[model samples]
Target: MESELKIVTFNIGKDKFGLDIMKVDAVIEYEEATTLPNTSDYFEGIINYRNEEVLPIINLRKKFRMPDFDDKTLAKVIVLKMDERKVGIMVDDVKNVRSINQDLIDEKPKIGGIRQADFISGIARLEDGMLIVLDIDKLITKEEKIAIDEVVTD
Candidate 1:
């Protein structure tokens, strides 16, 4: 039997990306977040989730240095479970869950001049198009992680 990996697909602009479904908690509609000062540009802000938890929203496009979408653009927030905490990532749109064979995933290439390319774990070939599989754990740098920790703790 082939090893299958489930992933949640989303779009950041025209580029399609996928995250391991195991790491995903939920996919929610985008909501206005309370802006925070002294935070990174990609750090959108925090949003109250289900009146229980405060979720920090990150702009994947900004983090990847991609073109920013306008406020009018429809977006979705993908809640990711990381390090015992939930972090929300804003994407242009949420696609759907897909099951891809582990053998189909190709190692990410060394793409020069692409910011955050290192975060890509591999590239999955789908019938429609290629899907960039992202490794969420490596998405943020150590310095950024420290800053995010400080903000979340406060």
Candidate 2:
């Protein structure tokens, strides 16, 4: 049987990336995060969503070592669920959900010496351009996860 994988596509600067749709909880508008102390630069602090849940926001631009957008009000947040934990990823914009055939995805290229490249699962070739597929679980390091867990509990 041919497998079809669905992904939520988002933009970070000029590059387009995709994450497993199953991991996505929701896509929300940008909200200012309360800065946290002792966290990584990529950590955009925490934000309360719908006045209920507090989610740690990760700035994709910072995480990817890209410059921040001049105007953040236009940005979007993609809420993702990894295991039992939830984290929100801030991006330039939320594109659309796409379904790609397994055959269309090629193995991620070996970028020698770039350890961060490991998070890239595959590259999906589309009519317009290639979409970089990221392994969401691998995006956050163990240390970051521990810090987030600690922050959420506190």
Candidate 3:
């Protein structure tokens, strides 16, 4: 039997990327984060969600070494629960959820100058366009994950 993978797609600048839908907890509006000191540039600090949970937010653009968007542009955050820790990824916009057959996804090619390529698990070829399928677990370094855990736990 052929397996199908559901992915949540989003835009960062003109490029399109996708994450396994199972990893996504919720999509929320972009909110200003409380900046923390001595953290990586990509770490956008933490935000309190509904006064219940504090999630460490990351700027994908900074992480991927992409150019920043205009301040006037509205953004959104994709919340992900990695084990006991919850992290938020800030994106330009949330595109939509899509389901693609596993066979359609191609292995990630060796590419230069794309910082986030290491985190990419595969590339899915869609009728409209190509989607870079990301492995959320590999998105951050071990040290970064530890920092996020500490931030959320505190």
**Best candidate according to TM-score:** 2
The pairs that clash in candidate 2 are none
- Candidate number of the best lDDT: 2
* Cα-based TM-score, every candidate: 0.93, 0.96, 0.92
lDDT of 1: 0.87
Cα RMSD, model 2:
1.0
User: What's the count of clashing pairs in each model shown?
Assistant: 0, 0, 0
Worst 10 residues of 2 by lDDT: 110-119
Q: Which portions of model 2 show Cα errors greater than 4 Å? A: none
Residue 36, model 2, lDDT? 90
Candidate 2 overall Cα lDDT vs. reference?
A: 0.90
Show model 3 residue runs off by greater than 4 Å.
112-116
Give the distance in Å from residue 92's predicted Cα in candidate 3 to where it truly belongs: 0.6
Worst 10 residues of 3 by lDDT: 64-73
- lDDT for position 32 in model 3: 84
lDDT per residue as tens, model 3, 29-67: 988889988888888889898798888999998888887
State in Å the error of residue 145, model 1: 2.5
The total number of steric clashes, by the backbone 3 Å criterion, in model 2 comes to 0
